[model samples]
Target: MGSVEVPSRHKALVYDSPGKISTKIEEIDTPKPGVGEVLVNLTHTGVCHSDMGVMCNSWAWLPAPTAQGQVGGHEGVGVVASLGPGTENSNVKVGDRVGIKWIASACGNCEPCLVGADANCTSAKISGYYTPGTFQQFALAPAHYVTPIPDSLASDMAAPMLCGGVTVYSALRKSGAKPGDWVVIPGAGGGLGHLALQIGARGMGFRMIGIDMGEKEQLVKDCGAEKFLNLANYSRDDEGTKKLVEDVKAITGGPGVAAVVVCTASNVAYAQGLSFLKFRGTLVCVGVPEGPSVPIATANPAAMLAQELRIVGSAVGNRQDAKETLDMAARGVVKTHFEVQPMDKLTEVFERMDKGKLQGRVVLDLSG
Candidate 1:
């Protein structure tokens, strides 16, 4: 495959103010792919909550604050417009559809990469952070690392699956719940939660219980949750937490769920996550809480020993996980509930997302 008609400049959405909710559309010079890389002509990108975290410099765990004018997006889908040196014999070629995810590139020689944990790669370049990201007309990805979008899936639908879908799927895989087991998901109507519900119930055959606000009950059930718990009904106090835990246990017939996947950024969800798991059950943490870090209040030593509970943290998926996730979407096993918006609406999308007003994911059309 040969290079296509490449543009010298293209439009991109940049974080004008690093510590606030602001984005500006600017025409930046298009970049050529380096050796063993491919330039992707992105047509669609998903606006993730993590992107907001980056823009606001909220996540303390990140090494440094986000710089102004950084393109802030990780879930981008498009086609290969050109390939650089050393990629001539690679599987990816010009015009082949692909997707870029959170972990932009990982040094294959790192310890984490050797263990197949790309998300924790010591030298990982995170998309939409210091490295240039997908919220633009074109972006570059390593030839060997880019996720190939399934031919049967549309670009708009494939965008959110790159991050939200793959993250939840990887978390579900780490959850240790088998088919027919009961699994609970906190924030089940949010972007990652809804996908977890569908993948857990339909793709993996787990009996899913969803927890969220009252308004999201129907959407949660529609996404394959066998039971829905309204967060609004329970107060944010200890007694209220006890009641919620009891309810979850009751729904699972006195024994708690086989696993609890906390998919929301709320610290309250993490505090209650371990309580909903049965003996020897697992609690998989997939959400990154904003602001100062807080320990899980319910994760006491005595309780952990008594129940033999296991807790694990999952980041975004690796290359293989991304492939499986897209395959699932291709087969109609999982679908993201999303609305398409133009590039200029990026700021409004972040504003609504920050307030929890978004019902599902939002995909940005980069055509404008």
Candidate 2:
């Protein structure tokens, strides 16, 4: 597949029409790697919540990215097949096991990117959104932005790190806590939350408290969380909520967690996440709640004043974070639990995802 003209066409799933949320398998021309680009033979691709948002166009502020016949996916793991001109500086070579991420490419000269915050680069291209993503047999990526996957890591385990893991790792960094700080991850049994628990607690040395259903106790605990708060068991009344808050503080030596990172795309989670924090605590929003722009429920001026709390939003991490994350994976510090599905079953996968039945993460078997 590298610099070989075996076929003029390849299989891909394209969103032929936006708003329809429909996908179809089609034979599309295999793309040639342009300048500073690389064509990869994709093996695995992680399905992200942001992909769901893209299907539905949840973020209205940004222009709708999917036009007719646009392909969708990011978080891809593959071997480099071809490199475009001027990509020598990217340090990528043919046959390298690499992963393509959400931030497809950034203009390094931009003010924000010059400061190492490439995610906010004004002229940034995003995989699965602005550009054709990785839900195909092969995809093209800018050499500079494609992440190098550790040789020891399986493609499945490395796929989700491109998005789910990167977002949480970046949020953990913004939380401003050190090796001994307490961090809470809401929806802890879900794909992003589970990985976050492992990376934040075991790998990064921040103690973790997982918030999810009672049935998820063992899963969360196994992921290195110190405690599990069953979201279903928590009270709905103000007094009961207060008691639940006290329990969190009591469990953490009476000062609550230092930071709460909401991994679920639920406004309720964000609201309750704030309640679990101690004074001067931080709340990092990694999830994009659906529908109209709803203000974070716990953002009360008085409560914020009393607690000296801070709330911040994290998009995704830069190249440095991706490198460190993959290095940790190489060291067996972070592990991803995933189910691999054939690209043909993508529609059914989305249906189950809409019903909240799929657990962990789903990685597409592009070659299949």
Count clashing residue pairs per candidate: 0, 0
Prediction 1 global C-alpha lDDT: 0.94
Off by over 4 Å in 1: 1-3
TM-score of each: 0.98, 0.94
Candidate 2 lDDT over residue span 96-202, tens digit each: 88899888899999998999999889999888876888888789998888898888888988999988888888899899878999888888988899899999987
What's the CA RMSD of model 1 in angstroms? Answer: 1.1
Relative to the unseen true structure, what is the C-alpha lDDT of residue 163 in candidate 2, on a scale of 0 to 100?
88
TM-score, candidate number 2: 0.94
Best by lDDT: 1
Clash pairs of candidate 2?
A: none
Winner by TM-score: 1
Model 1: lDDT of residue 224: 99
